[model samples]
Target: MNANFAERLAELPQYLSAHVVLSMCALLAGIVLSIPLGIQAARRPRLAAATLNAASVIQTIPGLALLALMVPLLGGRIGFLPAFIALMLYSVLPILRNTIVGLQGIEPQIREAARGIGLTDRQRLWQIELPLALPVIVAGLRTATVWVVGAATLATPVGATSLGNYIFAGLQTRNWLSVLFGCVFAAGLAIVLDQAIRLLEIATRDRRRGLAIGVGVFLAVLVAASIAPRFVPPGQAGTVAAGESPGAVQNIAGQTVTIGSKAFTEQYILGALMQRRLEEAGARVVRRDNLGSTIAFDALRSGEIDVYIDYTGTIWATVMNRSEPAGRYRMFTEMSAWLWVEHGILTLGRLGFENAYGFAVSREFSEAQGVDSLDDLSAIAGDLTVGGDPEVFARSEWTATRDVYGLGAARTRSMDNTFLYAAAHDGQVDVITAYTTDGRIAAFDLTVLDDPRGVLPPYDAVILVSPQAAQRPGLAAALGPLVGAIDDDAMREANRRVDLDGDTPAGAAAWLDERIAEQ
Candidate 1:
């Protein structure tokens, strides 16, 4: 095996252990807290209905949103605690509802027999009621165990290292093998945990003494191993947030740096390229990839990560909330000054390309309609439908485009980024919000309409560094060489290697780094 691949194989134990810790802790906490509440609710039908309704509402919120909400609720932290809480909330309903069902299903005759036998309420619960309800309660455990385990995969976005780490990274880098590994491992784990719970449920039957003790001991040890680490100091818990690698050692040139990337293919390649360049400059680098759209800014300000590549337009529109468009240099000037003043972040010069948003249509459609610009599209706006990632509809640029071009009643379709290209290619939408540098524009032979109004500001990819990282020796000088190095065609081809040719992000980065170094 290649040395690097072997190194990755060695890290699996670390990732697997961290994943198990998060999932098991969440599952155990869910079972322990939900059962008693379920019992109390069974005695009060009105309360049961209201409580279950609330839990159902919680389950409705997307898992990603729930995890993001916890970041602020927990005071700008992301990782184990927030992930654990979110998973616990998700597991509540099944366990809670089943607990209520199991408790209330007990016959009145059974309760009366216990009462006449001189048994108190608490004694009856432990001896008679619980003994009979054990199977049903175990069924709830079976359900909750599976739900929490599967949902735990979403924890990757929150900075928790679950099996999802592989999936999220793979998807961003276009590495299908990594994605398959994550999914298969997570699914296999879910099946095993469900089967174990089923065994415990079976043990609730009489004449299953051997199976009962064996399965009971297995669970006890499994849960015990998870619980024991909670009492240890966090650093010793064998799990870590970003940048907590063991030995805490040196990077290139005996210096260390952390690079961040938003959740996209281009960002992944840029982040990897930066890390590679930093390594060549003799600094050791760590990576925190797959951050949310705006999360990268906050993470940099708080020193959770050191550097990331962000677009000038994104900062102008999203961070500054500016609706006005300006020339490239002017927008960069304002953006750099604002970011420096507010967050102490440094915009390390542009990387020589503008990946701005453009409205695109098929070459044939553009030619047949003679639609060369936004104004031309606007003239026929009613006859066309627009589609893009949901962000395109909510962003200031979209609002400006809509108002300036008078697309008020034009049909709009919002979908996932993965589907946008195919949708436009198949003529599902007449126009699309295409990133100017996307390789698919060429592959699909689409014509990018001109923007006479310049509603969207320039989107020059620039490196951003935290205030502290800026002070490091030679950091700025080391990265200065990358400025104005990659152009539109270069970026498109780099992206094509990953998005079209199925190359991994790291592989694409390595190739680019070599080509740039040779230049």
Candidate 2:
């Protein structure tokens, strides 16, 4: 087996446990909240319309969007809480709808018969209505189980640990094994839970007390086993470092640090590098990878995350909402001052590299069109189609570039960041927004057009620390050495290791660390 696969397997218990716990909690919460409301709605016509309509509206709002919206709604709280809330809300509609339908479908004669027998309305509901509705209600629960389990994979970007970690990291690093591993486990979980619920439904419908008890016991055991690993004492679990005592390194012992990273290969590599450095200092590090650019910044400002890397241009264009050209150093200086004054965040200085967005084209296309710069491309812009990642189309950088270079006349296509290079190479797109540090530029033999108008801002990568984390002893001391450590070539090489050489982010980070030490 591959060493990387082995390492990922070691993390399975943690990931699987979190996934199961989260999905079960969300589904349970949905059942608890929805069944009661569903019962009440069944009794009143107006309430049923209002409640079902509300749930349907929420259902219509895409699952990922609802999850992302929860971050800001909760004042930048990420991880289990936001993810749980969103998934729970998502689970509500199906169960609630089913409950109301099941109860309403019961015959009037049945209710009349119970009323004639001296049973109150409440007694009639529990004894007659609920029993008849068991199968349909169980079906809803089964549907919700699958939905929540699958949707839970998207919780990774919100800083939650789940099987999504495997998928997100795999997509960024192009590791199909990791992606498949996450999918298979998530689907298998859904299947198991679905089957268990089916058994309960059968027992309930058939009035088989023994079978119901057995199914209940099975679920109890499953839940216990899934969450057991979480209760294991620290250090009793396997050491992060093989063959070394947990207390061997104590530079920043007893301190806890959280690192955040955006959803991409470069960010993943940088995150792993930071994680390794903090671990070497003996800090217990927690990583929140696969975050959106804005989500990461918000997390840092709110002190939910201790440290992460951000670019000068991103802060200027998005956070500061500034459009005027400030020289690279001036932008960095002003951005640092603004962050400190407004949000109490500290800028620990640049990492000696820049990964700017550049318009790139295949060598053959560039030579054929005699295009060497944006100025040259603008003349024939209307005849070509440009491609970029989803976020780029909405960014100020794209707006500025479009207006300045007359690219507004060109067609646009949004694709995954990793696919942009291949699209350009295959002639699917005439031009693509390429990251300067991406190794694929060289591999694909593409030409990055010169920005004669200088519309795009400089993107110097810098380290940022939350105000709370900055106050910690030795935090800066431990991380300061990395400020001027990696140059552009080194970063590109690190990215190349992951993108082209099939190295995991951790392995690439280790290779980069060795290179920096030699330097």
Candidate 3:
């Protein structure tokens, strides 16, 4: 196993940079906004009640839902902005509640003594109340910091590149190393930040010098804000010269173009193969693989990625979030229309492979029950249990088809894709949602049922690029030949090489490079 733990740790700097910066920004914003609200609420009971109530309401929402809600309201394309706002909203309740409690807990006699000394209201707050509240406020900040760090992991679902990228990518590929990597880094960040805050709290214990803690935190934040854009690396920054956008020329002699892929093995392999081809053609190529589908699309649009392969069926069903009956032509037409209207996204062309949906059952279950097509399976559904990934139940094709085709099982349970596959193979589940091109189908010798009712959509593997990106000179030409190069067998073999053979994606990519070069 070429799984270099040190190499993975070295890569940590790139992934953690975004997550740490966003988390700190949310915490700082929460502190600035909550302090005044907390102070006012402390002084005025009714105001305090209302402010805390609002913050509490925000806290009640699931972090994922809150992040999702921000998309429609703030333009879904603004990736980090929505996550930052949602995280900030989450930070407020703990800070506000603690702040109010801390200030209100101050003895009435202390307030009276400050006023008796001829101190003005502002003086009373700065000289007395704030100093007294410091310890408690720090406690609240500690609570909020932990919450924000954990919840920020959910940001990857909304297309912001973060450490959670490893978790999602690992889950799909069943590479536990990547998942563990994400968990460790995210947890480490929280501990580090909390300790830093504790050190500041200790250093600024004196009433007169307490504000130094706030000043130090503020300066640290300013430094981070100054460095974030450079961390993300601006378009055409550092390497590419001015006016030299990625994919701008029909060919490039020295500049590097990054290509990204979704988490699945096929996508990862294809992405690496594309980079290899580009590099062979004389351009320096960098690979960013195992990104989520939505995220990969976003990066392409942002010019963070130049190109990668995608399925036409995915463009129709997942990206456009649309439903149409199964047929390659119908799906292609509908998706092309939607992409043009909504995102100016264009499907360059289709790969030769048709990687459509198909349900799988253990060989024993299929043989025992005489189940084959969905219609036959629906007959015995009341006696069988079905397992699938959580998202399948909510997706239109799955939902609409389940109802339209009258496909049912005695019970439906949602698990992650890998788990679903395992359950069906072990006979713990009689049936599962599966993809035809998935290598596990062969690994477990599972039987795929015919969709006689045609409930499932045609998921022909296709490549999609942003209209703006496609129009750039040479991108289409560079990518045009790879279309229709792969078949279902080739895809399944590639996936098996990773899933069953325990090969790294880079190794799988190299294998694919050899195959494509031969073709």
TM-score of each: 0.85, 0.95, 0.86
Off by over 4 Å in 3: 206-263, 275-309, 317-326, 341-343
RMSD vs true structure, all candidates: 5.4, 3.0, 4.5
Model 2 whole-model lDDT (C-alpha atoms)? 0.89
Worst 10 residues of 1 by lDDT: 232-241
- Candidate rank order under TM-score: 2, 3, 1
Task: Residues 42-81, candidate 1: write the lDDT tens digits.
Answer: 8999989998999899989988788777766766565678
Return the top candidate by TM-score. 2
Give candidate 1 misplaced runs (Cα > 4 Å). Answer: 1-18, 165-179, 204-256, 279-286, 467-480
lDDT of each: 0.78, 0.89, 0.74
- Counting clashing residue pairs in each candidate, in order, gives 5, 0, 5
Write candidate 2's Cα lDDT for 366-397 as tens digits. 99999888888778888989999888998999
Query: Could you tell me how far off, in angstroms, the CA of residue 35 lies in candidate 3 after the best superposition?
Result: 1.3
Better of 1 and 3 by TM-score: 3
Task: Extract clashing residue pairs from model 1.
Answer: 251-284, 252-282, 252-283, 252-284, 253-282
